[model samples]
Target: MNILLDAAQTAARLPWAPLVDEIEALLTDPTVQVPPRTVLPMAAGAFLFAMPGCDARTAMTKLITFTPANVGTATPTIQGDVAVFDVASGARTLILDGPTVTGRRTAAVSALGARWLAPNLAGPMLIVGAGVQGQAHVEVFAAALGVKQFRIASRRRASAEALAAHARRLGLRAEVVDDADAALADCPLVATCTPASAVVLRGQPRDDAFIAAVGAFTPQMVELAPELCRAIAAQGRIVVDSRDAGHEAGDLLQAGLDVDAMPALADIVAGQPKARDARGPVLFKSCGWAGWDLAAARLAAKSRPTG
Candidate 1:
């Protein structure tokens, strides 16, 4: 029998700390298989994405869609579902809500990476973009890193205000700022979670800052400027969640980086010798991967108190 989890149920089950640990474990696990994502363009400017992965005990695939036209409607800009299967029997086992799974898992991975790479995180965290991803990052980082202040910036002030309000409810100090650069100044941590085609954050962050660029999935989309990438790359570091990052992450591609040249997040997590050092401004670019969805879904199955 297949189990189905809605948005609320999934949220209740998969909290930040455990979810972040699960993602951390999955990235370092040698038995896991995470293939590059396949992007298929649909009619009417929509995009269909397929990400698949497997572990020793289970496998899963997530199907999601991005429709630009759906922005103002009741439907979300991102819509999709994930299918989980038993690795041994090859039978379908669960179906998880894609949006919730994607949002939380993505944020969890960002938080996990920050936890390890930027161990001394402090001061205000600048969150660029005030959508679902923006909110998720705020919640996860506040809980995991104990960040006391958040400066939420978006092209839309109303959106930023709403996210700041949500952040306040979480017991963190948050404020809406019209200028993204102003928010970046003196901020120790920054998460760019927008889907903008052009760069959203300008100028250089503090030398000790840690950046998580979670938006700009396509080759034409970018959230960080090429100069920022160059600066971070000069340290011989610009971490990414997957090997396919160069191909899928526009922020790196635009900076003239070959996807294959970048180091995988797993290697850094495993404590490889040449991995990124603790000093300098560290940038973690996430282009999305299937293994993350698989890990989150498996955790959801185990975390459901009533199930």
Candidate 2:
């Protein structure tokens, strides 16, 4: 029987520690194969994404929709499912909630990047944008990194307060801030989770800060200003999550940074030597990849009920 997991069930299976470990393992696994995702345009600036990946044991594909216009609406902006298949027998096995998988995996990717790239986590982390990704980042970082303090900022004050409340409920200290740029000075960690076309973060980061830019994936969208990206590149290092980031990382692309020349997360995980000043500011630009979804599917598959 094919197993179908809803949002809560899917999330329950993908615990933070195991999910992060799975992603880290696959980062260096040569048998893993993930083709470039295909993006089809829909009316009113929506997008349909088809992402597929496979390993020696399992094959999975995540089909999802991205509708930017649904940001404030009751309907979520992302919706779909991840279908898992048995590679050897070519039998469908499991179906997991798509948005839940995407949220957890994307946040885990950032947490993994921080584990390798972040200089220190002594100070509070600053989160710009209080949407789904923002909340996920807070939860994952706190659970995975033992982070205890957070600062939330968003264009909508109510949203920021809500995220702050959510963080407090997790037994972490959280404060709502008015300016993300100003908060950059005190935070050793920063994450920009907005989907804005223009820049949402400006100014320079702290000398030893690790910033995860996860909002803008397409070449046309950006969260960090071009100048800020260049500043980080010149001062420290900018690591991308995958090779697809060469074209999908808008923050780096808009800044005219040579993404192909930068070190990928896989290289770092493989013990490659640093290419830039390791003690200075660091930025991790994440463009979503199917490999991450595959990792999630692998985890969910382990929880499948047997006859």
- The candidate scoring highest on TM-score is 2
Worst ten-residue run, lDDT, model 2?
A: 270-279
User: Candidate 2 overall Cα lDDT vs. reference?
Assistant: 0.91
Clashes of each: 1, 0
For each candidate, what is the lDDT?
0.83, 0.91
lDDT of 2 by residue, 1-307 (tens): 5388888888988988788999999888889999999999999999999999999999999999999999899999999999999999999998899999999999999999998889987759999999999999999999999999999999999999999999999999999999899999899999999976678898889989999999889998999999999999998889999999999999999899999998889989898554333769999999999999999988888854221
The weakest ten consecutive residues by lDDT in model 1 span: 271-280
Clashing pairs in 2: none
Q: Write the per-residue lDDT of candidate 1 for residues 106-152, one digit (tens) a residue.
A: 99989887877763478688999998999999999988768889998
Clashing pairs in 1: 246-259
